[model samples]
Target: MRNIRIGDYLVEKQLITQEQLENALAVQRESKGTKKFGEVIVELGYLSEVKFAQALAGKLHVPYVDLSNFDIDGEAVRKVPETLAKKYTIIAINIKGKRLTVATDDPYNFNILEDVKVMTGMDTDPVFATRTAINKAIGKFYSMQNVDSVLEGVQAFSDMNNAEDDEESKDRVESAPIVKLATTIVENSYRADATDIHIEPFKTYTRIRIRVNGDLVELMNVANVVHNALTTRLKLISGMNIAEKRVPQDGRFTQVVDGTTLDVRVSS
Candidate 1:
């Protein structure tokens, strides 16, 4: 699957006529083969990776995914061997029920789908992604096991705070838990390259989601009590009036993470 270039895929799928491929190939051959077929074709304004990814989605009848900022699940990642994942340019992203969701650059390869199913003993749902994306995902997921564990622990801080509803003590009533939760949520989202961190209040609880890879994925859920405090903290940090909950307000604040400054907007 690693060698299955987009040019062959386009030709095989009839998205690119053979004459077009042959012409592109001729250009490459004439250049002393210094250029790739897809490269020459793209340079000639015939195709692009983004357009090709869209076309591939149509050809395979599968959803095309942008893997940028996609947080790989650690448990799901451990289900498949890293060697197999790298060789096929595939990433095991999620597991739910009896289904294992795998993202890869080659969605047309039915063999890869079947192999993962047999190997993991879970039904494999193949998601199409760019080759560069698949490679990056695989590397990121396998490279830092310790960092992943720390993130999970940080997430637990919020959850542990929520479970103390019956305490009603100074600790539970204090802003420390909510502040810690808010800080953790922001830092985690920043690390994951999230476009926005959504803090939504739901009836008796709260749902925290982050925009990553153009998709909204749930990060955590905590008690509404915790969310209230967290919301106030966010408003204050963003320079919004924290007491005015009924009226919608928007403000932004800047933070420096790893030497890069980022602006975070808050609204309600």
Candidate 2:
């Protein structure tokens, strides 16, 4: 027996009308195999993203995961580095013996599954998730690892401040750990396609939030001690006046990540 196509399955399940599926198929063909049928369906407003993902899970006979409320294991996340996870749009959800289970937006991508298996040295099991959920989870979990490093850098910076004069301390503010933390924030924001990044300072800690899909999500928080250094580093790069605290400032800078230049607008 021949396997039923996704569009036919969707029509059979009453998720999308036959006319909508025909239109989606036409658009998909026009893309020269560049776009997936489900993507075309969602883009054309034939179905919601979540519903398409659920239907895809059923069609593929794979479990569908709602990452928004799911509790993720940190160890599984660690097994797959942030860079690799982002590259493939896959997140490690569980690991048992030599098998690694991951949540992915595209379960049919056998190449990615094979690459992950080779990289992790385990058999790969993929579950279905919406692309939006996978991206949010990556931003939420991977960025947490960087938060710990940023805190440690804050303590080391404090120690250096005690031993150095004002002039020398100004130079040390560009220390390695803090610099990486600052750059990582920008990179993550760019990767998430965020429209804005908010760094809010409070009495005891500083909050970092990014605007994704028109929603402001808190990325992470760090100690108040690192706030000054972090702001200074960002200001220097953006050409803002680091010495002037009372006045509002606006500036723009270009960052190169993965050979792609991104224009960053800063307002303080």
Candidate 3:
């Protein structure tokens, strides 16, 4: 954070391209040095604000705040004086005996947060957020009390209420056909108590098998169309490069089965 630039980090992480960075830099230059590189990239619709903040949090080792699901406390808002809040571009989100949780865009500005901890006589926990979200909190709790600045809070609240079913529905909607199929295959393997699920690609068909009790048991065979999609989906879930078939990669993820989370390892 002190020496490495954010753009290079994003590019190295495959979150953005070098071309996109150059274009954002051009936009920043054209702004007469007014806009920050991140602001330019976000304003140009190159990346979502939440994702940007998440990457920044990972790089800076700060906590990321998901504003869509945050519940603002009115008392917490008042703990930080309106003048200081606006001046430092921060908003208090929660407060305990002598510990205050605050959201701010600039986590590097430790002076402002130190002053806040001193003024309130409390320890401070910092969370990262987009500039806009902090402003919405300020508006909803401080200056513009009557403004409807929920930022999809109603929808998010409903999601929280029906979280389990809602999460499955949302995952289904976001997942491709092959992803869903891959999920089903893994679920079935879990139910069957299989040690390994194997998918082998052939010219015209694909063979699916499961290893149970040290024996490979035939599962099913699928046509070319299904096999291609299944292969791509498997690569995606395993965090492998689907574009490169010759490369060997390894990745692992956790899957919940019958209310229990299980680690599922994938390799190719």
Highest-lDDT candidate: 2
- Higher-ranked by TM-score: 1 or 3: 3
| Model 1 pairs in collision | none
lDDT of each: 0.72, 0.82, 0.72
Local accuracy of candidate 1 as per-residue lDDT tens digits, 1-268: 3455556778887778778888888899899968765467767777776567677676567888877756667899989898788778899988889899899767768889888888899998888877667765665566444344544544555566653343343344344555556666766677666898888878777888999999998877765656655666677778887657678998998876433577887778
Q: What digit string (tens of lDDT, one per residue) describes model 2 on residues 1-268? A: 2399989999999999999988999999999999988889999998999999999899888999998768788888888878889999889988888888899988889988998887888898898999878877787678767767766776677665542232324666688867877887887777666889999989777899999999999877776667777888888889988888789999888987544678888888
Better of 2 and 3 by TM-score: 2
Better of 1 and 2 by TM-score: 2
lDDT of 3 by residue, 85-194 (tens): 88888999988777899999998788978989887878888989987777656644563332122213322333334322312333432344545456656665665558
Best candidate, TM-score: 2
TM-score per prediction, in order, is 0.44, 0.67, 0.51
Model 3's TM-score against the true structure: 0.51
| Regions of candidate 1 where Cα sits further than 4 Å from its true position | 1-22, 27-46, 69-71, 146-268
Q: What is the lDDT of residue 239 in candidate 2?
A: 94
